[model samples]
Target: MQKRKHWNLGAKLAVAAAPFALLALLSISLTLWVSWQLDGGAAAVNEAGRMRMQAYRMSLLVAAGERTLLPDARSEFERSLALLSHGDPERPLFMPRDEDIRSRFDAVGQHWRQYSKHWLDVRPADNRGLREETARFTGRIDALVAGIEAHMSRWTALLNLMQLATMALAVIGATVLLYIGYLFVLEPVGQLKQALERIQQGDLGTRVERNSSDEFGTLADGFNDMADQIQAMYRNLEAKVSAKTAELQEKRERLEALYEVTSLIATARSLEELARGFVGYVARAVHADGVALRWSDEANRRYVLIASQGLPAYMTDGERCLRADECHCGAPNAPPFARVIPIQALEKEGLQYCSEAGFETLVSVPVRLKDRLMGEVDLFFHAEVDLSPSARSLLEALATHLASGMENLRLNALQHEAAVSQERNFLANELHDSIAQSLAFMKMQVEMMRTSLSAHDETGTRAVLDELDAGLRESTGDVRELLLHFRTRTNSEDIEAALQATLRKFEHQSGVRTTLTLREQGLPLPPDLQIQVLHIVQEALSNVRKHARAGHVWLDVQQQPQWRIEVRDDGRGFETGDGPPDETHVGLHIMQERAARIGARIEVFSTPGKGTSVVLTLPASDPTLLDLPPLQAVS
Candidate 1:
């Protein structure tokens, strides 16, 4: 069944007023009706009394034989009687309550008419007959008067009853009005004040007892429902705020950890060191029991454990290296992200690495550089861990950072290796160009001397022996100069000072007038590049002294838009095709190789019987940037 809605304020007021209104209306209507009845009865009684006066006047006039007065009185009495029987415009006859009053009015009207007819026929001469007629008419008028008197009395009694009814109705109206005021207005107002006080006291649980079906009841219920909803909302909002604050705090910690890890990785000098820092910091940041990193040693075809921390020694002792099919690191079937696994699950799958290592959970992330997988990092936990998506994303980012940093370190190391290899090749070429050529010349001279001795030409043998001695001394001097070149450093002076020193040494050694020009002053190069430049300059000067057969050389180091090194000689220059199999041209080739290693270009300009110029020009390199691996191949 459907329940009715509570009455609104207007409806409550109307309900309270309705009974009073109805009683008041009934009382007013009864009183008005009773007063109307009394007025009609009193008017009829007055007309009857007036008719009695006119009837007495008519009798006096007839006894005096005044015919004119007789007609006037008779007409007036008859008119009053007619009006009582029927109705007049001014005073209409009343409808009686019963047949007795109506019949009395009819009898008075009939007797008066009969008396009027007889009095009109008889005359002033028949006084006795007139007197008899008057007596009979007077008697009827008296009866009529009595009836009017009784009618007035009855109407008066009815008016009194109506007055009592009015009083009773008024009493009912007053009682109902008082009850309405108490229940609807006064009582509800008191309850509302109590409700307000409770609300002011912060008691949201306060609820009014809904006893009446009115607006106040609805108001109380509404307030209660609103309070409940508000309280629930407040609680829910508080919980959400607390949870959000916790989440933000956690994010702040993670960000701080990442910042520290980034700084550590940046300063780490080697891949192993970087991996150790990365794993340690990541484990501490996200809270893990242990971390182990493995790198693939491709040349050895095995995984080498590069970094391990917070793990049992037994796990890393003999297990530092793993073959392809022996580890659970997706060696052949690589997953894209870190694979989280329970130790029990791994044990079930016959992968006992985590289980034997005494870890309950294991997570492995494969380090990659683009398409190639480099290694895998394994994270272990002593307790169960459910990886959230956010956690997994953070782990993936960490893995990416490790892989990129390690790869950069490896590349740097490889660059150093290449630099060393290049230097070795250059030195071997230098040996062939200077010392080896001298030795070959000595061997040829001895062979020639032996041929002369066999033919008995002593002059030819003596000349060849002299040449051989000079060659030995020149080779010895070349070796000493090579040692000096190694000792030249910029610790005490800049490149310009070093260049001037090298020119002075060349002038002393070869008796060549060496001059150096600076195109842009304060030209700078890194220590390693400076060493390479010095060695190349030494080789060029040695060539000028030993083979150019000239007296002067010029060294021009310039910075236009970039750096350029030029060594010029005013001596006999070799042709492009002079050295067979590139043997005599080996010095030029080695210079070009050195230039190429440092991302520079070497240009050789020469004409036979004129001069030779070797120039290495490099793009402008920023001195402020820290670039590439350590180069120590100047030897």
Candidate 2:
């Protein structure tokens, strides 16, 4: 059989009733006993008073010579008085008293005096003494009565006082018992209830005070223990939740960083721009000095610096190229502050060589596009700093992003190069088809006219033939000029030679005088860049021939730290505006585009009725331009 669980009501009622029941029973029993003692004391006092009066009476009778008052009676009376006098009011009446026996002796003396007084009438001389004794006896009887009255009064007063004290004590005891029950039991129970309510409301830290070693103290101790356990459990749970939240936050940050890097790399336009952005990102993410990108030039047998940030200006602009075997990027013998690494390997050998140089520590990542090695990236930092794993991981991710961006940039460059080549090819074909055909047809017509003039009999026939021959010669010169323009494609051609040739052709075709000016010599230019400069010159010449109705033209090509080409014509010039026209003249637009492609600037100056002057300026290439690899050559 399953044991039944006790109800809370039953348990609480038992606890509440047990102490009260015990106290009530004890109080009632004590009260009853005390009342009985009081009653017995009152009865004993009454009996003792009566016995004292009887003893006084017997002693008086004995003084008066009254034989009716027996000795036995007197002794019995004295014994009763002694019992009353000796017994405690609060105790059972059972003991004797010597004071009661002395009262009996006084009664006997009073009785003897009374007898003498009675005999005084019969005897003459002896009667006088007897009469005095009788008077004394009367006084003794009165004193005995007074003593008996005083004993009775004292006994009654003591009984009354005891009864009153017992009643008052019982009332005080009941009140104290009620107060103790209320404080220890009811008040504590109420406090416990409040504590339980707080605990139910999730106040796990709430606890009760244990004031005593009683049951309530035990209960309070148990409550405190339970609260402590609950608090500990909650704290542990909170710790776990906080830890999980932190981990999630870390993961979210990583994802966000990854997304940012991806977006940045995907939208970057140029290597320099990409490098600048990459360095900022890595420096902020990993707390590094800066980032640098270098590429290997196979044709020149050197590694060329492409982009850098946070490096000295001299290092960035100085000899950026280095031989493969002589690279100082990761060399121990290099400056301690330098951070150098080979990002991509040209051949099968891995890493080429990596060095921190003057930097304390460095991380390198190879920028590879479509599995082909493109270049290397180096991240530098001070020696005292250490990169966290998360930061390092982020940097690696950034490196990957840079690699993809670099690949896209290279692809775009290739596409642009292909498009330019195609345009050049189309232009060449058009020139050959249009101008060459027109010149050929004009030549045929002029020849036919010459033949017809030779057959005529008129005197102006020679003059007509001569005019036809001059027209044919002019047409032939125009075709030759067009072909010469086509031959000046490569930048390697001498600038002075190309300019002189174009001006001479222009003079012959346009019937204009042209002068060539050279301010400096040995203008070294990279082949591709020089091609762009030559094109700008070509566009300027074309504009002058078509628009400038000038009789004489001046062409000046100056070379110093910068390349400046100026073409001026003494023709009717148009009004100067914000910039050259965008659509009405495609030549100017083409010239601007060419200048932009080679990182040059173009300026046009013109006034109404005055000559138009076109100027093109380009930053001078390194003096050792020829010693470097071709821009398109893979290194």
Candidate 3:
């Protein structure tokens, strides 16, 4: 394995370049110091040369002593020379006695002294000698001054050339240092920065590679090693994740199989059918020898085997009584095989059963609805099989679903039966009140006419005629009442409106008083129940009119959580023990049947001198029942 270079290359490069940067700064300082010293030397020489020229000019003026010369000339010349003795004065003429320049300055001063003496002596001589001598000496002094000026100009040009060369060298050195920094430092750091950015972006494949055997190279090597390790770890993690994912997929399929079995049971229409299907599915799913289902019928207080499959005939068909301690499947100390199992204890005790049933192990699940024990499902295996936790959970879930479905089905059957009975009662009332009564009245009228005609003589014919007319009127009224009864038989008519119309017609026809009272409103009774209620009212009113022969009828239709209809008559009444006339007692029987169909009870009250009152009380309509078509009157 290669040694890893985990350190950053850019940071290493910066560390390595720090000494070179310091060296470059030191070189720059040395060059500046040397140039400054050279400049100072050149400036001193120039200032000294300028002072020499001034001294020579003043000496010539004093030697000539022309009338233009003032007495202040000597003083001014001494002051100018004194400036050279002060430290770093206005002139650069500080030459020591040992210097070659000091010897030249002494020789120049001796020559000027000689010229001054000669000129001063001749100034008092003849005019011609003075003029000639002064001209010659002045020409000599001007030539010497010109030679000194030429020497100083040459020296100044040399100093300027040295300074320019030093500046050029400093500029070139700085440029070289900058280029080196960019190549070795900035360029490598930029590459390292880009590599780090790629790593941050999740490109673990990035590797740093520097050619030199420096700190940067070590960093590159480390980076490559780290990337390699990370890649290896990532691959290993992927393999482990793949294995776990496959395991989860297998578990999901198993759970789906369990869900399918439960769904099949839920859709089964009857308990027997549902249990048969459930057992078959479970047997296949769990590979059981057989499955059995038993339930406790609360009303009968007996445990019955409602369904079974792949089981012995004795186990399914035989009548069995369940004890809290005994196994119904002929197993010893086996799981409790009752409709209500101790769900919480099923896992710990694993079900108490007898081993004699030739099964090594059995699992029993209780079916409960709203805390009531409705049934149990039992599966028997030939030998103990290792059932997984998921399998046990699925079984429990299925049991819960089965419990709810069974309860719902039971309620549905009861409601259907009640609806059928209500329909039958409604039909009976329509037949008796409308069709039967119409036929009976027609028969009575025809017989009466026949009897009168048979008894008639020619003179007594008018009397018979009057009797026939009265009977015909009564028959017509009966027929009209029958028609009205048929028209109102349908329960869909607003019950209150229908009852009011019926009473109004009765009052109009018989010239009797009628009143209706209602209590509670907005009760949505089912059509069948409504029709049964309507018939009860109609029958009570009919009996009142025919038997009680009451002058006034008070019909009260009331609603609460329960439905009730009561009809009272004020007329000659009979004893409660007195039955309806033998030929016409069907009305009372019809009324009782109608009340029973809607889960209602009817009561009748009467006395010899008081009126008759019939009351019908019924269970209220269940709002959740399925809607049915409106009833149509038979007519």
Candidate 4:
């Protein structure tokens, strides 16, 4: 459809005032014309009255026999008649166009001509007759003046009438203009304002009416279009906000479930505890009817149920263990990614447990760490379950946590076993170095004594017996020292206090004077490091008592940029090519192993006669010891 043509605001206002404008122009034109006509009217009356005086003067001049003065009077009277006929525009003098005024003016002119010719020019013998003619002439002049005055009065009245009519039309035009403005501009503007207010008050449906083909009409259409767009945008915004709110709520639930599972992983001590907690939380998180967690062997040949929730007793017992081909849930043929399986489909493959238990669907999430599929989490539901991508991802994340927890527990068990084996080897080394060597020497001495008895040498036999007694006494001391070392414990955390106690015990037992000097200047060692240091000190002390044969021993500990401990004895020292071999002195070997465990170095210094010193030096910063690996058993 073609659009209708419309005037803009400026055009509309101009059109409305057109008639009044024209009326004003017409009234002004008429007033100017009437005033121009009246302008000359007074001058005509004055000129005519002067002519009457001139006519009376001529009659006087004729009667006085003054011919020269009479000529001047006649010229003056005739000039007045010409002025009244032609009108003097400069003096603003003019005769009216009315025929009565014209005729009266002409009669005055004719009377003046006759009186001048007969009485003044010809000198009439009777002065009374000339005076009478002059009198009639003046009367004619009076009538002409009256005619001019009447004409001016009528023009003036018409001017007043034009002005009054103009004013009345102006008032009417203004009233009509105001009415039109209200209908087109003010009323439409007010409607738009009301609609805007309603829209502000949340009423999106408000609109304006298009009442005319003008600016106001265009404005009304725009307003309605704007309202429509706003309403549509508002509706779309509400929908998006609702969708976001629901998404946020779902994420919050997932986070809560993950937190619960994390707490279980942190505090749980065994795989059983972790799996049980995990299945319960997973069932609640995914709204499943039942959940089962299972572990797969390295060959992927069998599955073992670790924990289960909301499962029937019969189903749990029957499916407690499954070979690779026994059940689809535990089968190696299942895909690595998390999946949904129907119980009826499983039943078609000869797995009747789920169908018998009335489960319609099963969600099996593979528990994996990197590429290793360690286990599976099976969720059972009576109704078929459709999981969203986020829900599926959440399930997979829970499976990963389960896998990590299981792996951690396995590593912990392996570390405990290794520690036990390491301790056992240490005991064997100690016994072999000390007690076993002493027993071998005693056995050889017993053989020497029997040989001497057979030879019947009294001095040799007596000396062999003395030697055997000494060997027995030395072996007894070794056994007691081994027992002491084995039973030793670091009851206090303070390394200084533990060392002090060890020194006092060594002095009392071995009957040796000992001095302990500790100079501390750095942070205390970690408990594991401290234990290793203390054990090395005790072993050094044990060696001193058994072999040093010293009168006094000094144990010095310095804690600073590095930790250093020196066990020095004033004993008949052993000869050193680098020091005694570890095979011969097992205490030295044990101390070296303990030092290596804490990332420390051990050194032995000895002289044939002066003394022997065993020094253990540990660096303050040992990155290898920061995250120490599990101790490997050594024999």
Candidate 5:
């Protein structure tokens, strides 16, 4: 097939209109030529008629015997004849080229020449019937006029025929133009419209046919290219949307796993429970077949399996304890990053148990807290599995959470141990200062009583016996006081209630009238601090019972402007020479030690024959109390 030529819309339209334009121009040119030729026909006819009129006028002048008029009329007749012979171009008078008309014109001119000469001969013989002669010449003039009229009539008919032919050609040209427009413009536009409709209706596969190398063809090619791009973009968009949805789903799973592990950490009472729950959740989240959690020593040498979600019983037992240098799974010293290693890549001795279980892939994630390598988590897969960055990150996050949970449990255990040890020490101190000191004094008194008995001093022995009996009673009371202090527990909600209970018990045991005055002004002290304060108050009360010998003891507690407590006794008081507390005043020392533990100050005021008052003042800005955790069980 021959390649077609390309033309734009303007060129196509111009080509379609060119033939009609030429035909119209030719038609108009033909009409103007015919009209121009006929334009002088009327003038020629009028001039010929004027010649006949001049001939008749000349004859009449001759008949009138007016010789002067005859010459003038004769000259006028000649002038007309001359004008007819050579037509006036400026006046637009043109003689017809028809042979009949030309012959008749010549006859008219020849007859007039002969007739004019005879009429002017000046001889009567030359003159015949003037009318008859003039009439004969005028008849020839009439023939010429008739010939001109006949020629003009034929040209007018030919002009009408030419106009009719032009109209027919114009109709044919318009019909052809309409057909071309339908083929080139309307049909192509229709096809393009249908293709656009298909695309708009969601059929991205629609394409236009490129049948011609024209504007429509270019348009078709462009449309096809655009459709290709749109279809490609649509496909790409669908892929992107699918990938995004999958990414969001993966993220959601990770978040859920994190939340489950976080809840486990918060609620689990032991590291084992937290690790078990963490491994189980991680295995499910990442679609792993088996998961194991391990803990290593500070030096990262020994690994102890803390928890496992899935594994053979034998494999779990055999791999329960492995060193970092011997195990392929929990090698914390190898690298800090989580990695997916093929089970077969490991040495047979390191992970032969995993390979024997038909596991193909293993992912080891390190659990770290700060800079210390805590342990590693191992995930086993039955089939080969590739971990994306997101998946690996999720596993690492779970490991980090596990590390934090384990560390928190460890810290809590240490804190509990420390608290227990401190309580034990406090009890020991209380025993040594009170009961132990009392026992040592009784021992010395027994020695003195023995010495008196050996001397046979009856008064000294009786006195020593009374003193020993008093010492025994005092020791019994101290034992009971120690027992009360050991069993004492403070109320967390209200310290006043615990203080009231202590005072009631003290008044009942010792028969010493006790009064408690409490004034609260600010937020209550923390439970730990309150417990220490209550213990100090108890110690002071114990001293009042043993040594003060007061009738009434008053305990005052103030919470405002700093925690302040005072134990006042109206009893015979000993002198306090402030160098250090008397070695025997172990109660005062114990009270001061208890006060110092909670950032409080203690003061003892006593005078001979006057009362004694023990005061405990806590600083307003005691930062140590804020960090003290809730008091643990005393035991």
Candidate 6:
């Protein structure tokens, strides 16, 4: 099998991590952006402050040159002038970028050039020009210092505001992220956990209702699927118990019912009591709100309500009869099949019998044999009920049991009856799908052969003869298989022995060393299902004998989640594809058909020159269906 892609734990974690990842990214980017904004004003303000310091140094050097005549001070003053003229003295290659600070330095340079020209000749009389220029420069220097200070104060205020805003943004983003985590992550997960706890406590109906197209939704779907499977398991286990209980109880009841009905009919006393008793049993067994037995009087073109249990006033109107057209029992001309049907709202008022009792559904079971509908037991339900497949099957079986009871009543009227007639009816349906179809094919072949023989067409006649031979052989094989099925009725307890016998027969016929392994402790299948399984195994082995030409074959029956049966052979295998069934591999159709009837899955694996294996898996909860082989020969 190819690997299928699934969103696993890692994917779920990734989905959960998305919000936090976004939050981290937001915090880091916001901090960097805010820090960058605050730092923007600092460079210009720092540059302005540095230029003011250079101006102060130049003023001190001019004062020293005017007062004490320090040569070093003059030299340093000239160096400071050169440094300020260019920009940063420590790194003279660079120029200042702050426009305000650079413009103040330009004013300082203009004043210094005039002050230096005058102070270069420092005479007492010309000291007036120097002092005047010095005063003006000093005033400009004060204003420059104040401007730099004011710029620093404004930058500090803006930085503080930005930091506050950034902190608020950070808090808001974190809070939003926390809220998102709580709403989308923590809360949903908590709900899911609580649901799981409830499920662990045996609440199978608990659901995690995630309505998003995200991981949570997928998880919800998975949970629901698991719940469904677990619920199915519970139902299957319950049904199995019911089946076992019913198998014991129903068998006893059926026998008792048959005997009592036989005695009642034989005595020719109180058929109404019998009918009423049987209807009541059915109503209680199937949990119906009410039940009524209605006898069909086709001769009078009406059906008369005969007996009832738990019925209300509106249904029979103190005993009533209905026309053929008004009958909702079944197809008038067909055999009665027990069916569960819902009450339609539109037809509610018209159905007087159902209207008063307030039933949502009904199971109409005709006490019938074929189209001879003697009467019907209608089971009404006041509310809807979830009917499992097995329950429905059990109800159907009970209906048939009732029909058989009614038929026995009639049969008792006559002193003697032909057993072969009942057997014939069963054979008719079985053969219709199998032997009857083959016979129809044979008839066509025979017709063609006759035409060819009449035309004196030797080649056509010979081919038709060959075809007839093959068809006859297939029909014969079918008969033989049916004979084996009818004669050997395998039960759960007898399956091991039945299989051993089958294997011995195969070994004798094919000269292949056949081995049988029964590994389910002992096959624990329901008795009614054992025969079908036995038939499938028999057909598979028969196929191996006819086609495989193998030296050995292995038969294994085991349980692995379900019952598994494998028939493998070490023989040359054929290519497989959809086409016509090959003559070499006989009984394949019969095996597949039987598996299908039992709701079992069957697979055939083979490779050319390698080997062939047939595997069948039968589920425990599989419902029984009508798979009666033509056990009687056609008359």
lDDT of each: 0.75, 0.61, 0.61, 0.81, 0.83, 0.65
3 versus 5: better TM-score goes to: 5
What does the lDDT read for residue 429 in candidate 2? Answer: 49
- Across 453-553, the per-residue lDDT of candidate 6 in tens digits comes to 89999999999999989888867766665566556665445567888887886677568998888774633565557767877887787677656778989
Tens-place lDDT per residue, model 4, 451-492, is: 888888889889878877877887787677666655655555
Off by over 4 Å in 3: 1-19, 45-242, 247-251, 254-267, 277-294, 299-324, 328-363, 379-393, 439-635
Over 4 Å off in model 5, which ranges?
Answer: 1-243, 330-333, 345-351, 445-469, 486-494, 511-515, 518-520, 578-586, 607-610, 622-635
Query: Residue 433, candidate 2: how far off, in angstroms?
Result: 4.2
Q: Candidate 5, residues 1-635: lDDT per residue as tens digits?
A: 99877688879888988989899899989988888768778888888888888887767767766677777777777777777678777877888788888888889878877886788746345445888888899899888988888889988998999899899988988999999999989999999999999999999999998988788999999999999999999989988999999989989988999999999999989877888888889988998999988888877788898889889888899998897678677666567778888887656675488888989898888889988988889999998888988887888888888889998999989988887887788888877887787788888888988999899988988988888898789778878877777677765657888888999999998899998888876667767777778788888887777777799998988878777899999987887885323457447788878777677799988886677888999888743456664455453
| Candidates in order: C-alpha RMSD to true structure | 12.4, 22.3, 11.5, 9.2, 10.2, 26.3
Best candidate according to lDDT: 5
1 or 4, greater by TM-score? 4
Q: Looking at model 6, report the run of 10 residues with the lowest lDDT sum.
A: 88-97
Tell me the tens digit of each residue's lDDT in model 3 across 1-635.
99975535455556655665665566566656444443444444454555455445544564465625623543453443343233242433332323344445444446545644554324544344544554554454344344444555555565566566556656765676577667666666787889889988988888878765656567678777888998788879888899889778756755765677667655777867776777776676666687876776664245566666676655444425554434433232333323323223344332233233456566776666656676667777766665677677666667777777777778777776765565455666655654566556556656665765687654455655565575466446545655665566544636777778778777776777998998887556665556556666766776676567788889887777666778888887777776554335337777786566456788888876688788887655653252543444444
Instruction: Please give the lDDT score for candidate 3.
Output: 0.61
lDDT of 2 at 246: 80
lDDT of 3 at 276: 72
lDDT of 2: 0.61
- What is the clash count for each candidate, in the order shown? 0, 30, 20, 0, 0, 1
Arrange candidates, best lDDT first.
Answer: 5, 4, 1, 6, 2, 3
What does candidate 2 score on TM? 0.36
- Candidate 2 regions exceeding 4 Å error are 1-207, 210-268, 297-302, 313-319, 323-358, 429-433, 449-635
Ranking by TM-score: 4, 5, 1, 3, 2, 6
